[model samples]
Target: MEFSWLNWLYTAIAQVITWIHQAYSTFITPSSGLNWVLTIVTLTVLMRILIFPLFLKQMRSSKKMQELAPKVQELRKRYKDDKQRLNQEVMALYQGAGANPLGGCLPILAQFPIFISMFTVLNAIADPKRVSVFGMPADVVASAREAHIFSAGISDHFFSTQSVTSKIIIGFFVATSSLTTFLTVRQSVTRSIEQMPDNPMAQQQKILMYISPLFAFFSLNFPLGLILYWVTTNLWTLGQQHWYYSRHPMPKFDERGRLIPVEPKPGLLAKLRKSEPAPAEEPPPAKPEPKVVRNQPTRQPRSKRTGSKKS
Candidate 1:
């Protein structure tokens, strides 16, 4: 079942990519490497737009996790000796609050298949014999093979190509991608620490802050087109996160990881919520009437006035 779903996903992604390439080919010179480059960037934009709701969910989940940090810390300290109990309590807390500790990872994980499919498509495009998709034409395939950036083929990798041009293009992609990733991670961690200085997750964030760039560098051998795709997406994430943080700063925390009691300024979403009217609550159902008693006794006036007059 999973394989079937994944196959469907890849097929769908291939269709979208091919459609975009064809659209670009209509007006742009297909022979120009710049045309393919622009197509990849445009594809990234469309994908981001589609997955934006996932991003919003991630943001909300992250904020919820942040809000629960203090409780998590308390759990850690309280159950420091019993690791099992600590784990149980943490899970319980997350579940009770309807939060997923891994919620923020949803968007990234969802994009994984799309990324792989794009890579596959680009690889196929580079090979003249294998460059056939449902709607892509022979002319587009020929054009893709001719597409070159800085004299390096769009699908060329550092290890596969002998040209200095390939090396330079790959190097530029690696450097920019790594740099942007580092900046994004650093900015995120710094803000998180500001909101909760004592955040128990600080250590994990610290590790990621250093390791993310390393991961980016490791992708140096990926196709120039894919690297370009990554660079564009990373740049988008960098800007989107910055905008989000500016509007909705994380809750501030003190040196000890305790939440500072300052009133939080509303974020973009919060402002929208504040502006909208609340839903009207439904009225409670009316209570049933009590049953009447059967055959109840009736009262009568006394006849003592005639006896007093006779006396």
Candidate 2:
């Protein structure tokens, strides 16, 4: 059998979910839908915690770029005629800041594999008549099929299920998840305008901000378990971003789309300088000694002095 990396990832995620389910099932009912929902939530939390360093790096990269934007713009104007030099200078600035143009993308890139793996594993387990899937154990897959949240089967889809209760529960998750996604995008767009108002990419970011929520409607076709996982992850993202921004808020832009310079608090050195008494004014340096003028004897008339004149 070929060694499939994606399948391996799916198996790993499935195994973790199984372990979480087993732990939660100790006190909660082994077959309870609540236990399964809690299991998925716990799994999502763990994944987010594991990936937070990537998220932090991405955030730091973005912040560094934002801080360096004015300098980058200055460099562009200073070396507009020298493309090679400008590139060198920009690269130097990034290096000095320990920021990479690609760093902002790491979190997104890291999430794709995890997201796909979780989706695959859950979709497989959600199926009523599943064969071998992602190499996950048969018992684990079978156990998940019996789980339900709010009377809706864990595998039920909003459109596939006929029960109104199931639709409500699934719809609620879809709506909340989509709304959080939109809010996150919107927050990023606003910051982009402040950070790089003239950026052409801001328009595309705006388009995504408005349209992101629409993508959530596809949850109607996804398994309830997957949607639940998505909802938990989105909520986590929403909270994380909110907390970050609350502490390190992005600078605002003026109506003209210029970044507003924030006034920094005085540093320790500055405060000490301000608090210390002014140095005593030094006495003016003594003036240099006056030079004495020598008097020259007056000369007689030209005729009288002509005795020594040459012929």
Measured on C-alpha atoms, candidate 2 has an lDDT of: 0.80
Clashing pairs in 1: 195-252, 195-253, 198-257
True lDDT of residue 152, candidate 1: 84
Tens digits of lDDT, candidate 1, 54-161:
988878877777778888889989999999999999999988887786876887987787788777766767665675643456677677778898898888877888
Strongest candidate by TM-score: 1
* lDDT score for residue 16 of model 1: 73
Please give the TM-score that candidate 2 achieves against the real structure: 0.73
Q: How does each model score on lDDT?
A: 0.79, 0.80
True-vs-predicted CA distance for residue 63, candidate 2, Å: 1.8
Alpha-carbon lDDT of model 1: 0.79
Q: What are the clashing pairs of model 2?
A: none
For model 1, the stretches where C-alpha displacement exceeds 4 angstroms are 1-7, 131-135, 199-201, 253-311
